[model samples]
Target: MPLSESTVLISEVGPRDGLQSVKSVMPTAAKCAWIDALHAAGLREIEIGSFVPARRLPQMADVADVVRHALALPGWTVMALVPNLQGAEAALATGVHKLTLPVSASEAHSLANVRKTRADMLAELRRIVALRDAQAPAVRIEVGLSTAFGCTLQGPVPEDEVLRLAEAAAAAGVDEVGLSDTTGMAQPAQVRRLFTRLRAALGERAGAAHLHNTRGLGLANCLAAYEAGVRTFDSSQAGLGGCPYAPGASGNVVTEDLVFMFEAMGIATGVDLEALLAARAPLRAGLPGEPLYGMLPEAGLPLGFTYADGRLPRTPSIPRQAAA
Candidate 1:
């Protein structure tokens, strides 16, 4: 089947997911600047930061401020990660454009990571939806299904469990449910099957695929997901992130490589390769000495490499109103 529009959504997750894994705390100003640069590169949606406790993740201490700064940028969807109802309320208070709630498919991993069972997570989702609807119905709610493919604590997670949680999240009132390869254990075949089931279960409500490159199959899994009709993909700038709790896991898929793959395939991701690579400046400056990963920046783009018709991330002609 031919792609209808030849375009895809590449969501930058470096601010939230990437920074949370590393020890260095990027200043709020640097974060805002990095986000602004990413937007200039044509990225429409970016996970600015997670609304977690400062004591836990000091890297995102100024998430509220970051939200304000990001919303000021035109043609950007400023997204924040919220762990529970409290985080959701705080994020809502900041008037973020989008909020994500994470739920794990593995019961063991869920309990260990968030100290909540899958059932408990579902119940929390219900409360969160009520709060969001009553208080900020305009803010989009996405439930990120972590460990949907596999888990470090429990090993292989069941597909039925993943699908069940996705359906429950959709029913609980989340606008979308995205799959996460939290431990980097997903394979191409597995990605295809699970994403197919996910889209079938939720239709357009099936959101992004947040894949990791721990075993070097991140791109393969992403390709599989794309083939299964997933349009939104989450990647970290310079591939600078991973699950801290998942001991052996590596970083999230590299934004440059993912963009290169899609655009090279004659599919438009709307992300300018050179400009996106330049956003790494803030990332490197913010976390000096921290190892950044990616093949494109090191190798440089191919001589004749052209973007999907050499197009940049399409910015809307009209500026959007900030979520108030």
Candidate 2:
């Protein structure tokens, strides 16, 4: 059966989420090139990088520079992740179109990841939202209720608590709030239920679905969220990020595969699956020997596969990348 929804936003997160977890560092110019290619392929919103301190995440040391380059591109929404009020301020200074703050619903994960309790994180959200309103009201603030599905440290995150946080975030003055399966513990049923409850709680303020492909259910969970009325999604190109459950394990749902899923369903993504796949050239070149993963690239499109527009990828010719 065809999906009821006809449009979806595949927000690319490989620059921030994917690179941060990887040991190798992609150069700043290469990062800009990758972002350019991504935008060229029709991804409107791209999480170009994060605003954390360089000592903490060296891979994102030149975030401001990358953001500057992305800003120059026309018709693209530049997004960056901020860990707290401080990072949020820096991200705002970059004049980014969007800023994302991740708060873990799981108490243990909160303490482990950000070294703050859930209450403390909420407090930070309050302060960040206030700062954003006072300084840059034009910039959109997004709060990701991270680890909502389940936590690697605490496990079994309650649905009520997740909904409560979403309410709190909405009340805290954020422009939007979304659920994140940081540990890839989200099942399809859980996704549908939680998204429905979140929509009930926050109404139209409920935001994107940031899912991990851990255990190979990323695409399934995304579909479930879509059926629940979600239109925006966060995915890493080539599945570049790691799984928190295994600490250094594989990545988020592959962007190429996710786009393929939506386009194959007659849903419009506006992304050229072939061009998006070709964008991986810069990624591989940036992080040589990093071992990228994706289904579309390996198996190739199955026989008779066609995009939502009834067109196939431009060509089977592979994209070439500059030496790292």
For model 1, give the RMSD to the true fold. Answer: 7.1
Candidate 1 lDDT score relative to the true structure: 0.88
Model 2 bad stretches (over 4 Å): 1-4, 243-250, 316-324
Candidate 1 at residue 106, lDDT? Answer: 91
The alpha-carbon lDDT assigned to residue 261 of candidate 2 equals 90
What TM-score against the true fold does each predicted structure earn? Answer: 0.94, 0.93
Residue 204: error of model 1 in Å? Answer: 1.1
lDDT of 2 by residue, 1-324 (tens): 122368788899999999988888899888988988898899988998889878878999999999999999998789999978899989898899999988889888887778789899889989988898899989998999888998877869999999988898899899889999898888999999999999988888999999988888999999999999999999999898863333534569999999989998989888987778789998888888988888877766665667787887666433223111
Q: Which one wins on lDDT? A: 1
Displacement of the residue 253 alpha carbon in candidate 1, Å: 0.3
Error of 2 at 279 (Å): 0.6
Worst 10 residues of 1 by lDDT: 315-324
